[model samples]
Target: MITLAGKKALVLGIANNRSIAWAIAQAFHSAGAELAVNYLPDEKGRFEAKVRELTAPLAPAIFAPCDVRDDAQIAHLFETIASKWGRLDILVHCLAFGNKEDLQGPFTQIRRDGYSLAMEVSAFSLIALANRAVSLMPDGGSILTLTYIGSTRVMEGYGVMGPAKAALEANTRYLAAELGKQNVRVNAVSAGPIRTLAASGLGNIHEAIHKTEAASAIKRAVTQEEVANTALFLASDLASAITGQTIYVDCGFSIMGG
Candidate 1:
């Protein structure tokens, strides 16, 4: 049993109960880790309220608003963590976004702003959060981010998000190397297609899921809970030696040659 007793974990990007971040938070809470969760702020406050409600059962020590695009918000989130828990043991980043327009058309037709937005939110935000998180992890910690097979393979309809994920995986490796001396680990989980609010933005998610089920070794798509379990193992001391790699939870879809 990999336990996170006495650990403090901060999970960002939980939009709702269906989010992979939500699943990871539940798993962490179940394993005895204290939690801090973040939600992206919107003009209407709907996101904040929904996230609060969904995380209510977990009883997170801090549930705050964070827009990764804003440096001050990110700083504030980590500062609050430092003031409250005085340290962090685990950081789970499950955020990614791309314009629906960018995801539908030809990859070459992706708008510059859309491409930049996708890269900033999906890829660079990991570096930004890890930068702030490291200060709160003096004793070392685990930083886990979500990626996808689209990062390496060109999945149709995935569009600019593919390049964004690619950059995220590269960031994972570099951060892992730089943080290793401190015993802090960084890794990415490449999860299979699932029906989540985020995935709903994709034009062909249903088609992708069906294709994945038909071709994958498991003959099915993975659930959020399954991906969350893999995250638990990586976050716990059980995976102390694992770092700088993208662990695929894609039901063996990535291994298929055709």
Candidate 2:
């Protein structure tokens, strides 16, 4: 059994029970890893309250607010980890966002600001988080991010997020190379379409899921738990030598020829 006993894992990007990050957190917890989770800050504290209630069953050791766009919040998050756990063993990054306008319509029509926002939130945030996460990972650790097949192939309605995910995959490789000396592993998990709140923004999400089920080798869409299991393997010593790669949990959807 792949066990993460005593390992401290920080999972970011959980929006609700349906979030892939939430599933990862649950998987990590089941594997015996100590968990820390993050929620985006809002004026009303609604996000914090929802996350706190949703994660209560798992009893995460550290639950805090982190807006990856805010350097101060990022620093504070790492500071909290440092004060509470001293060191981190796994960092799970499942964050991604794109404006509604940018996520549909013609790619050429994408606004500059929307494009920039997509890149910053979906791609650049990984680099920013990795920068801080490495500091807390004085010992070797795993850093994982979520990506998608749209990053490589053209997927209608995926829009600006396609390029953002492409950048994220590129960043994964580069980070893995640079951090290998420090024994830090960086990788991305490319999951099949799911009906998560974030994915609901996409125009062709239902079509994508149906097509994946009809044509993929497994003939079904991959579940959040399935993706989370891959994350669990990557986070544990089982994948000690696996890094700088995008492991697809897409029911082989990416392999079929158009």
- Which RMSD values do the candidates have, in order? 0.7, 0.7
- Give lDDT for model 1: 0.94
TM-score of every model versus the real structure:
0.99, 0.99
Off by over 4 Å in 1: none
Which residue pairs overlap in candidate 1's backbone? Answer: none
lDDT of each: 0.94, 0.94
lDDT of 1 at 247: 99
* Clash count for each candidate, listed in order shown: 0, 0
Clashes (candidate 2): 0
